[model samples]
Target: MTASTSHRETTTADGRLSRYPVFLRVWASQSAGAVADQLLPVAFALYAVQRGAGAGTIAVILAGRAIALVVCLLAGGILADRVSRPRILFTADVLRAATVLGALLTLNRLPLAALGIVTALSGAAEAMSRPAMRSLIPALLPTGLLERGNALVAAVQRSATLIGALVGAAIVAAIGIRAAMGLASLLFATGAVAVLGVRDSVAGARTRTGVLADAAAGVKAIRRRPWVVAVMTAVAIQLFAGTAPTMTLLPLVATEQLGGELGYGLVLAALATGALPAIALASRWRPRRPGVVGMLALSSYAALPASLALALPLPVTAICFVIGGFAVELYFVYWLSALQRQIPAEVLGKTLALDQLSAFALLPLGYALAGPAIAAFGVQPTLLAAAGLTAAASVAALLVPGVATFSDPVGTKSDPAGG
Candidate 1:
């Protein structure tokens, strides 16, 4: 399915995004911080290799981070809804900066176990901030401008990460890996300072609801829109099928069947390049039934792994990946906008947190299964299975009551809390 055949006004009368100096300040701050965040894997990998640690050690460090992120996400959301989101963001970044500094100072001297713990701490700090970041925008702008706000945010995040990866490479090349980490910390500190401009009011006033009750309400709110569950289920299953297999098997396939590291890099670059247009597309595109359009767009992602299983030529596979990339962004941006528009502002933070946890909590299982599956069935079969699982999950979303039928200007759907 294609995007809707029309455009929406992307900004409002009192202010465009650029007119909001505080938003601009937060944007620049978060952009620089995001770049530093992109440097983390490189810094960790380089340090481990230099210190005679193996891939297994690096994996353990990464696993620590991922585990912490999943565990902390719900709590972060609860806190964001209950208190000040900007302060939470500021605190999270500050904590991340400190953790990076500690890791930098003790890199060579720190024990492997200690390093893993520190990495997990950094991840936890990041988890604490994300729900606040995601939910803050509804308070910053009227509902009408959400798509545009998301578009600008997406642009900044993607562009910063791309630039940050390159800059990280340069930093690692010129100085030591430790220096790159120091730079990451400095960038995070800058982000923390930038968020200071956002007053406590950027998040709506804290409701009188109790924390646990509010969290329950978030879940109840999600339940009211059965399609939300369908969307989350589809996305989670897709991630479970896509992430581990792609990370583990795709590199091997590139080496065995395609051009090796160069081919692998090219395919990844294709995905990134294709996704860049989504920012512009999402800003103005207004579909009559965004939920249905989003599901169909997401289903296109299954084609990528299917192509890999076919042992297609590098060019063919890259083309498939590009299609998947483009479709995936359309799905993400539209789904996010839909959630913001449909879900209540008071519960948005908790709902976002719950959404994140559901999507990521199963990733470890995917990793654990990928290698064994490859061992038993071989690369072609493993990739085919991933594709099949992704396809099944996405198609399953269509069976849910409202996913295929929900229309735009989803009026009553917006206030399911009955507030």
Candidate 2:
């Protein structure tokens, strides 16, 4: 059967994802997994502190995981296309659980090198799960509901992240790091069980290409699509220039200008709070030119850097953060939903991986550069530059041929679901 036909068959006639048992299972699995994913890192960091590791040691352990995730994401994408995505999800959760369990047992007794290896394993498992989780959505939901489904997924993930981080810290503070790690392991195992109920569907026709060729093919697919390249470029610029500097400077701003940790926490809470309404709106709104609208929305993030650069009052800066958060959620919901529909199923996993890779690969470099840039040029100049570049990239991306509507000029109107 065609991919479209398969999607329709799996979904209910009303196109409500909630009515589909398999989709519910997939959703449950993701919620559990998302919480576990957030919880583990926090717990690990706290555990390291409890074991008397210094900031440098903690940073190294965390960096190992982040580096491993970047290095392994492509392989995860390739495997998702070839293997059963549900199985990949299941395996990833199990592996994560094992890694957390390992940390729980050896965190104090083991050397830092051993802890780093454990974190790396957790990161690799996280990388494997991501592409599979996203690609599997198309298999469960109909075309008409893909946007809504994506919105729900985003909402769950964002909420889980906030909840997981708070809960992880709380648990660690209350009962110590071991209890937190134990809970994280249980959450991962629970996610694994939840995913077992999801129906397995192959994402694409099997390919016999060698691994290197498979990776190259994902690249070629992007080069063939001008819109994909444009959007990826825009997103990469947003993460690198806009997000990195904002993150680096926000803490300093909070300490010097605002109260302190409380102000920083409040600002972050506002950012996340703003996303809730945007997520709800995304579930219902279908803009005619999603690409154009989404890109414009993405430009709203400039408010955040501008707020920090001006050292706006705590309340005002927090409001700008709320706007930034709203813009990001709205933009990504449209962007990802459009991509799921536009890209051919055979290469969807790889394409999504490339999208993520482009956005994330520059982040570490951006973070590293942010402090140095601020040190040299001052925070105001550096932050304003980031804001300007973010806006410029978003506007420029619109000039690309397919980006205005996120579709080929020759065929976009023919799409029955519109943008």
Candidate 3:
């Protein structure tokens, strides 16, 4: 852990989070913001389909959003270090709300180009906000509580996404997409209100360093810590091989076998259902070698694709997703907590942006490939190939000395090399 992080380990009188009321307030804001973040994707997909836009059109819109997010993350990262994180986040939230509100104005008559633009702009705003929000946590909490803090934040976000999906779906079905968009805008506004009242530590973190110099420091931090880069590379490969493939293949398989869109959604929800509980469970569990353990945990993702390739029953595939989702959440909580503790607060935002860049830059390619592979080689072979690739990636992660030996500060040597 960084020297500053060691000095700033804030805790409650009896482990009650109420000890840090400001952090809890930020978490509340984040949870509310997540509702807006989650609503747009599902809304866009639904509205596009409702308007007779085909898969290709929907793909373009989603792709536009992802690309924008990836493209803006670095800038966001830099700003978080040089500006007040809460201000950055609040501004982004307001901007995003404005974009969604504009979309709501022409909901039924929304043009594909306009939809793509709005979604991309919204993604860009989120890209700026994400690292700011993550970086803010370390400033608010201590090294010891990073895991629990991250877990609570993650759980709230997952819950928001879950609830937002259901509520957005119901609104779209019962009322209209306009109502869903209105709800998202309202959520974003609520977050702005919450964030405005937050007493921030990040204001003191802003520096007079040039943007390029600040960004370079963040890069050097990752370069100095070889383990961070190694872990990020492995995660990138894992996303390309495992997460993206399952996301693409599941819907196709569900449509063919289970029922249709409803089946596909249920399978997706099963993963979230698994993940929600895992986040809560992880709050109390701190693994010895968190970075290493997270990498190994990712291997669980191989199950879903392997199950699909075997032409398993729909229930079995959903069960596999459930298992995979738990692993995914566990890995996320550990990996993020490790980063938050290990990295210095000064460069944390930029480092996280690099992490986000690594994680996002390749997944679109996986999604792009999955469709053609399913069309040509068929769903079974495509899923089987994805499973193999995910397994290979996991094994490759173990070969990285840094990933293999990395350990937590509280500290047990789970691996022989560390001992």
What TM-score would every model get versus the actual structure? 0.84, 0.84, 0.89
lDDT of 1 by residue, 88-207 (tens): 889989999999898888777787646668768888987898888878776666667778887777777766655565566556656777778888999899889888867756345466
Winner on TM-score (1 vs 3): 3
Candidate No. with top TM-score: 3
Q: Top model by lDDT, which number? A: 2
- The TM-score of predicted model 2 comes to 0.84
Query: 290-351 in candidate 3: lDDT tens per residue?
Result: 65667777887888888878878878888997888788888888778777756767778888
Q: After best superposition, candidate 3 residue 305: deviation in angstroms?
A: 3.5
Give lDDT per model, in order: 0.72, 0.77, 0.74
Give model 3's TM-score versus the native structure.
0.89
* CA RMSD, predictions in order: 5.1, 4.3, 4.2
Candidates 1 and 2, the one with greater lDDT: 2
State the TM-score for model 1.
0.84
